[model samples]
Target: MKKAVFLDRDGVINEVLSSRVKFVNKPSQFYLLEGVGEAISLLNLAHIPTFIVTNQGGVGLGFMKESALHNVHKKMIAELAKYGAHIEDIAYCPHKPTAGCVCRKPEAQMLIDLASAHNIDLSGSIMVGDREPDIEAGKKAGCKTVLIGDESDNFAQANIVFPHLLAAVPWILEELH
Candidate 1:
């Protein structure tokens, strides 16, 4: 089976939106965090399939429509293309926390679904992201978890934590080999 890398959107991929970048409802709002494109390209060059696991509750919460999210993703893909990186698959949970959807991060269902659908060997895969939930999902899915930020000095779910996605590359490459 093949291994994959799952990435989170929002603060992990781009700066967390605020009044200035307020929700990424359009292509213009889609910006890449420093080293994101290069990091993704590095994973691509290493022959790792990359996937995006995002919690787009904005749609369910009425912050934006689904079409807007699609547009932003399309733009995001085009931008990544310029750097020779591409996401193999994308999955999102549009439900809010109150809705308790299965696909939400920290639940592991998204990873499980993707693993099954993509024929991934969960044990060999790594889930890299910035939030606790992202790491938790990886743990629950039985993959190696790498937290892409030292925001919280104490993250119990992740086996490892680094300052950014770029820092996690060599480990991911090693894990695949």
Candidate 2:
């Protein structure tokens, strides 16, 4: 089985905007955080198939339509391509927190599905994100976890903490080297 490095969209690969007020209802609101492309490129070079698994509850909340989310992802992919990096797959859970959907982060269905579909070895895989649910999901999926942000009460479960993706890249590579 192959290993993968699962990533979160918002905050991990891109900037996180709650969009609670204005709501990122359109593609124009999506922005890539600096250095994300190079960071992902390193993962690719390391022979790790990188997958993006995110919780896009904005669609279920009526803040944005599903199409908008698709468009944003398309834009994200295009941007990444410009830097010569590509993501292997992208998955998302559109249900809001109240819906208690199983596919959302903190649950491992998405990871499990990907592993089953692609023959990924979950034990060697790692999940990197900027939030608590992302870490939980990785753990539940039996993956190593990395939290890219501050390490307060918000990310107690992460195996390693980094300030950003670039900082995390070396450590990820070292794991294999």
Please, what are the lDDT tens digits per residue for candidate 2 over residues 61-99? Answer: 888889989999899998898778899998899998789
Alpha carbon deviation, residue 133, candidate 1 (Å)? 0.9
Best-performing candidate as measured by lDDT: 2
lDDT of 1 by residue, 1-177 (tens): 998998888876776755568667667888887788898999999889999999888888888888988988898888788889899888889887678878888889988888889999999899887888888888888888888778474375687888878878888888878
Best by TM-score: 1
Residue pairs with backbone overlap in model 2: none
How many residue pairs collide in each prediction? 0, 0
> TM-score of predicted model 2?
0.93
| Runs of candidate 2 exceeding 4 Å displacement | 18-23
